[model samples]
Target: MNAISPVAHPAPSDEIDLIALVQSLWRQRLLIGLVTLLTGVLAAAYAFIVTPEYQVQSVLRPALIKDLDGLNRTGVYKLTPAQAMQRVGAALDSYERRLEFFRANQGLFEALREPGRSLEQTFESFNRDAFKMLQPDPKKTDNLSAFVGIQLTYPADINGVALVNGLVEFALASERERIAADLATLVKNRLHHLDLQIAAARASYDASKEAKIAALLEADSLKRAKLQDELKALRQQLRTRRDNRVAQLDEAIRIAKSLGIGKPTTPSALGEGERASQGSVIRTEVNNQQIPLYFMGSEALEAERNALLQRRSDDFTEPRIAEIAKELQLLAQNRQVEVLNKRENEDLFLKDLATWREEAARLRNLQFEVAGLKLVSVDQVAVDPLKPIKPKRALILALGLVLGGMLGVFIALLRNMARRIPKTANSAY
Candidate 1:
């Protein structure tokens, strides 16, 4: 026969192995039940003995338009509803503010103290673990309005509702006070800036007025000097003309004495009478040359010369002399300069005075009362929860049964495998 090849035998199917495993588990059913019962007991003990924590949430939304109307009307702080919500939210999230509340209301958090921890550390732990800030998801489409909430999980013995509500109130009050203070400070600073501007504008106006006065005075002085110069030239011209006339009169008197002629006789007058007597149409000569001044008689010329020499002032001779004297009198005092110098309130003329005053008045008259100014709306106030949130007994018992069954099955399979391994080794030897 050919070398006895080992007869090929197929391995057991998965179904057969599964049945055997079920049978093995059934054989250790009492042990499995005992382990499961032990686990269930432990779970029950933990579920009943653990301290239950109750959850309380205080919800907040943006204040109504009417509620914030006072602040909006003030115009100093132009806060929108969204901005108001953000302010309250920021105040709620501030750790320093929370600590301040904690310090002030130490009695409220006394029950939260843990052994071996300082008061601050205990409060820190409580703040970190027990408190949660709830906000809407920004990516979601339905989250239109800005809402925020403070959630607190505390032991059943603690007044969680009161605590959470107080926290929310504290945050709102703190934010309101901060807004008021900021508005006051901003108004004060603005007023100071406006005062400085008014002062500067007044100084500038005064300086410009002074400059204008000086310019007017200088122009007046120059004009007066020019008028005086014109008057002097006119007076000199008049004096020289009078002197020439006097000299011409003297020459004319001498000529008349030598020619044996006197008493205002012109050359035309002497010859025109002779031509008329001849009766030949009496033709007289006309020429561009002016008549000589010496034609007047010596007595008349002498009398005019004496009057000119005795004249004290030639101003009456020149019409411009009166005008110059009047202008000089007017220059003695500038009416515009007088008005500017006597002005008492110069700020009224500033370009921005009305605007600055209106703004400052608005700031000063703003309503800063935190009690009336609603910064946020309480959408949901904290209320005592009907049941604890932690130590879910039903879920714990179900989990315990499942886990215990798995553990029992694992132990049974291991024991069976160990016994089979020893038998297999004995048979091989």
Candidate 2:
């Protein structure tokens, strides 16, 4: 009896259970089919009702001024290709900034909306459907690549392509104006700085000239004073010698009279004769006797007086003074020449500054004209896309069908588990 035992019946295998699960699902096929059909119908309805989005793309190349050789040579400041490219980059950034501004100020996009729509509502709707994409081309070996790809997406109703083009044009125009204004301002500032430098240089030169002239005048004044003092001393000495000679002649005449050699001569007459001699002793007859007392004085005194006269004449005609005067005259002439030269240089500089200013103005006008004509070179303009890029109906329908079938299977499994649970509980009791 022990052996006859439940001759080892193996428990049902996992494969059998899996087969059973398939059978259970087949039994609920109607419910699964209904749910899957409903889901597919709902997906189809959504696909048809939702609006489709269209994309427009354009390719653009920055209009860079490549040949700046002439401009560089003409202007005091030079603009380089790299700098131009930098401006292009800035313009691109400005384009983005303008887009942000458009977002903040919704009224700007009102014209692009449907009739009867408020500006705020239109902006919200447009923002929901519209977007812009800017992609720069990868750098090349030449490093001068300037192509960019732009794309705009919007609902089929609006003119997104034209709007994007207009915005780009506006951005380019603004950028050109900004660059021109900046360049003009820089040129004017440089000219102003040059003017300041010239004024300072002229002022310094004038100060130096005045200082030199003052020094020269002081030296001349000192020399002239010294010579004048010397002349006065010579005149005083000559007067003293003449007086002494007159006194000696008077004394000699008195002595002769006292010795009874001759009649006495009047001192007044002798003094008057001495004065008439003009710096020399004069002989006179006194009571019919010739005194012969005419003193010529030493040759040295005469020579000294003559030398003094010569020196006085030399004071006015001294070679050193003449040389100094000539030097002063030459210095004055040189100063005048220098002043003239400085003025001439200043005038030339002012003329150059004016020319540069005119050039800057002309360049600014040219830039404005160019911007007005064409902002950027479009390699390919955006075209109206024929096909929509959203709401993939086939994929959605397939996913919905699959998901519905899965949900039906889950519900059937849950009900089967609930029934088994009650049965197991009853068995346990």
Q: Which candidate is the best by lDDT?
A: 1
Task: Give the C-alpha lDDT of model 1.
Answer: 0.81
RMSD of each: 5.5, 10.4
Per-residue CA lDDT of model 2 for 1-429, tens digit only, reads 365644564543334377767788788888888888888888888887888777887666644454444445535446665564455445544535456546654454655767787655665565555655465545553444655655677766667667566555555566667655765676667657666766666676667657866666566666656655655665565556555654554555455444333433444354443234457676554465443442222343344444544443332533455555555455444454455445644434332556555654654554323244333467677777778887778887888889888887888887766766776666554
Residue 349 displacement (Å), model 2: 12
TM-scores of all candidate predictions against the true structure:
0.84, 0.58
TM-score of 1: 0.84
Model 1 clash tally? 0
Cα RMSD for predicted model 2: 10.4
In terms of TM-score, which candidate is strongest? 1
